[model samples]
Target: MPDRIEQAKRALRADLRERRQIVSSQTRDAAEAGIKEQLDALVDRLGARSISCFLSTPTEPGTHAFVTAAVARGIRVLLPITREDGLLDWSVATPETEIAEGLFGLPEPVGDVLGPIAVNDVDLLVIPAAAVDRHGMRLGWGRGYFDKTLGSMEKCPPVYAVIFDSEFVDDVPRDVHDQPVTGVVTPTRTIALASHHA
Candidate 1:
């Protein structure tokens, strides 16, 4: 049986997911463009030569455009290839990298598989989240993949969660297993939270 906190988190995650699912195509497109712009600014600010990114699905705040653009600019882009154990294996995501059906029906890189700690080689890390709070606590998609990854990093690079502006909230339930992000990048705003936990 799950704890009360986990149960509450599941409810919240479900609600937030439903909200994301209803976003219109035009709105999603506009948000995607805005997110790409903000992401570019973040890359410039961090001077990140190599970064870990995700390939977004259509409904999520888009990362596809930003990933491709970053690669074209000579930035090394690492994308996650989910493994059966719920930990991520890293791979270089190029414009030509083959996209194949991956775990959870998401598109994943079909390139050389780098081990889990491959993320440590990057200067910055960007990940997906269902919601984020002002305190930097993130609500993930009820799976512990990223939480495990971030928790195990000895020296994690600056981590940011890509989310829609509306999904940025004041309160998100967190437990010992939950991981806090360094910041959140929304389409219209870039919010940097004070250090809590990486």
Candidate 2:
């Protein structure tokens, strides 16, 4: 049964990946702008002085503008660095920080590496997602990176997954190890969903 669920997730993610890649540069630019505004507003609404967020891939909803803007606003932002052990290391994103491709080819920050525990101090977490159901169940890219991090945290803040508006769906495959997010941040709006874990 679990294998079948995993298969379903893979199929859905493949479709999402294709769709993301096909998005026009013009549309992508508009999306990034909207995402930046929504994220900024979310930070103000949550009063998140420090936050952990991923450096989005080209296909994903872009967070680069928000990260840059956040640092300029004096908000401490931590970017994820993937580790060989399947855990995420973190680095503080300074204006001068450079991004390099990670082990998985995911864009990661180039800086002094901080252990996974560095994320514990964050006031909020904004992560990438292929899609999110109304109930806040997230379909990740199947690497289980975000899943492991969220599960290991002793005290988790409001975790919001960044996704395109069309990616907000009715439901997604949920494995036992999967973690639900507090809400989703899309290009159009930031919404709070009722997550069992939240």
The C-alpha TM-scores of every prediction are 0.96, 0.98
**lDDT (Cα, 0-100) at 65 in candidate 2:** 97
RMSD of each: 1.4, 0.7
Tell me the tens digit of each residue's lDDT in model 1 across 39-114. Answer: 9999999999999998898779998889989999999999998889989999998779988889998888998899
| Candidate 1 global Cα RMSD | 1.4
Task: Give stretches of model 2 more than 4 Å off.
Answer: none
Q: lDDT per residue, candidate 2, 1-198, as tens digits?
A: 999999999999999999999999888888899999999999999899999999988888889999999999999999999998989999999999999999999999999999999999999999999999998999999889999999999999999999999999999999999999999999999999998656
lDDT by candidate, in order shown? 0.90, 0.94
Candidate 2: clashing pairs of residues:
none
